[model samples]
Target: MFFQTEFTHVIELFQLPFMQRALLGGILTGIMGGVLGSFTILRQLSFFCDALGHSALLGISLGYLLGLNPSLVLLPFAVIFALAVSYLLEHTRLWTDALLNIIYSSSLAIAIIILSFVGQYKGGLNNLLFGDILAVQQLDLVLSSLLLIVCTIYIGMTLRTQMLLTVDESLAIARGVSVSTQRTVFIVLLSLVVGISIKSIGVLLVSAFVVIPACAARLMSRTFTHYVLLSAGLGALSAVLGMVSSAWFNLPSGPSIVATQLAIFLTAMVIPRLRSVTHSPSTLPPQV
Candidate 1:
């Protein structure tokens, strides 16, 4: 019995490398998602992020077919797409949602066509579609970590300006905030974060990394600072838990992580509802 137990323990230990990478990646992703997501949520740009997520599929396919590093390739594409979209939004006066549809839908269709043409390899599209944490190399981990650090510092330094712009863009412009440049900078930073997180979350669901925890935290917190921190913590926790559970249960890490995040979001939603039910209505009359 002792030998059997030892054997099982050894088997578990064998998966540690994968788990370690996933945990580390998840932590960095959480920080990125949390900080950038706060901006995303505040700017009401979650749909833009979702569109960018789809745009990443184009970059991924192009990278694979061309034999380049997907993230590096995707970085430029994301930046270009972001810039183009920003320019269109600012100059053309077209609705932002309409622009997003034009960008994402076209990119996605192109990606599907390109990827389908590539000959199959083991786990071929799965890596780009769902992510493969076990495949993360030391270089990938280092790159992701560095990007996360940069994003954290950049966002931290500029958060006040971002907040001002988010609340009232015209007022921020009136106060000499350079709203256009700041908005441009913000989009670029978001692209970098999304580019870095693609290896772990994949092109398909990466926006969830930006949107889910932020939404969940919005339900639970009122202050911006608290909301950002809570969202980051929740994002990291969900990533770690999802990765571990996926490994243990032989599930897909990407979907599992997203599922866990959604569960947290649901819980947050329910708690407020439950509290509202249990607490009695105020006896005082409505404010005049």
Candidate 2:
């Protein structure tokens, strides 16, 4: 009776307009994260995405300093930054990690300095750093939905080419793929995704969305397609479970979702091992 009551209460909670919006926003973000995250993991650009997330503050700060809307500048600024990083990496001999670190640290410092001068912010910094999915408005949902569609169409068209490039640059080049151009395009897309997601997932935890689900799916998938699909499915599942838990327990939504993904990753890790142990010849009853 207690379990049924709890379940019914949770169902009723979702009937609220705010909860519905949060659910839609989270699902959109999750799907985009999973789709782009598969490539992020494949190309070992997890840190790149993380850097973009943190560096988004610079864009937000710039908006405040210039008396413009942060939302207006955020995506464009992220894209430019990503392009610059890509250009430098291609043309320079700097180590990828070192270059990214330089940019990440410097961007954060600059943003802080600018914010200090900007006097007051409409939304507190914690909201930017931690995110509040329950605060999602209709505009946020519409933007997220549109971005998801764009991301899906782009990924669908370039899936094969991107996969080949990820597997082997030399092979990709041999097959007439424009390696540099594709890389640039992907980085730009990643920047946009990470930039937009920072509003809901927060800069600190956004990378988890792109990394954890893919990592979990990797453990159980035999094919690349399976990995991609499972990662997206897991992402959506985590978001829903986390949102539900957040409402029930009155917890922070972003961290709740990230925690849920972490739990799923741990489960994925254990399941394969459990299967292996169960199928071991030693565990079999005389080959039965």
Candidate 3:
């Protein structure tokens, strides 16, 4: 009865406008993260997402300095950062990991230096670092929905080529897939995902949405199609679970969401092990 009552209360919380927006926005962003996150995991570009998330801080700092909404500044800044990173990787000889590492470090420093002067005005530093999902705005949801639509279309058009390139670039090239072009296209879409989501999930935890779900999906997926759908499902599931738990416990939504994903990861890991044990030949004595 107590659990039922608490569940009722949690459902009631969603009647608030802010909660409505958070749930809608979180689900959209979660779907995008899961979709691209699978490709990112395959391409070994998790750190690239880290660099983009960190670079968002620079844009947010600039927004504070300029008296603009941080999301406005974040959009262009993240898109440019993604393009520049892609260009550098294609044009230079530096290892992808090393280039991202330098950007990650430098961007963090630059953001801190700028924020130190203007951070007092943009509703405090905590919001940028940890996020405030209940404070989600209407515009944030609109922009997130638009980006999700664009990403879906882009994937529908290029999914096969993207997979081919990731699996073996030489084979992709022989098959007439333009590696550089596909990378550029995907990076641009991914930057928008990070930009729009940062407002709700924060830069520190934004990458988690894109990473953890797809990772957990990898353990149980039997085919590529299964992997893609399962990853997105896991992402959306985590967002909804996290939102309810956050409303119930008054916890930070971003951490709550990521924690749910972590729990899923643990469950995915253990289930495979349990299956192996259960299906193994019996070792116990056969009692008459």
Shift in Å, residue 245, candidate 3 = 1.0
After superposition of all CA atoms, the RMSD between model 2 and the true structure is 2.5
**Per-residue lDDT tens digits of candidate 3, residues 123-223?**
56788887888788888888888888888788867778877887899999999888878888889888988888888888899999899999999997988
The residue-by-residue lDDT of candidate 1 on 134-240, one tens digit each, is 56677778987888778778777887777788889888988899977888888998887777778788877889989999999989998987887888888888887
Candidate 2 residues lying further than 4 Å off, grouped into runs, are 283-288
**CA lDDT, candidate 3, residue 180:** 77
| Cα lDDT tens digits for candidate 2, 1-288 | 987888888899899999999888888889889988988998899998888889998998999999999988999999998898888877889899899899889998898888888879744788878777888889888888888888888878888887898888999999999987888777887888888888898878989999999999999899988888888888889999999898778789999999999999999999999999888777546855
Misplaced by over 4 Å in model 3 are: 282-288
Off by over 4 Å in 1: 1-15, 120-123, 281-288
User: What would the TM-score be for candidate 3 when compared with the true structure?
Assistant: 0.94
lDDT of 1 at 72: 74
Per-residue lDDT of 47 in model 2: 91
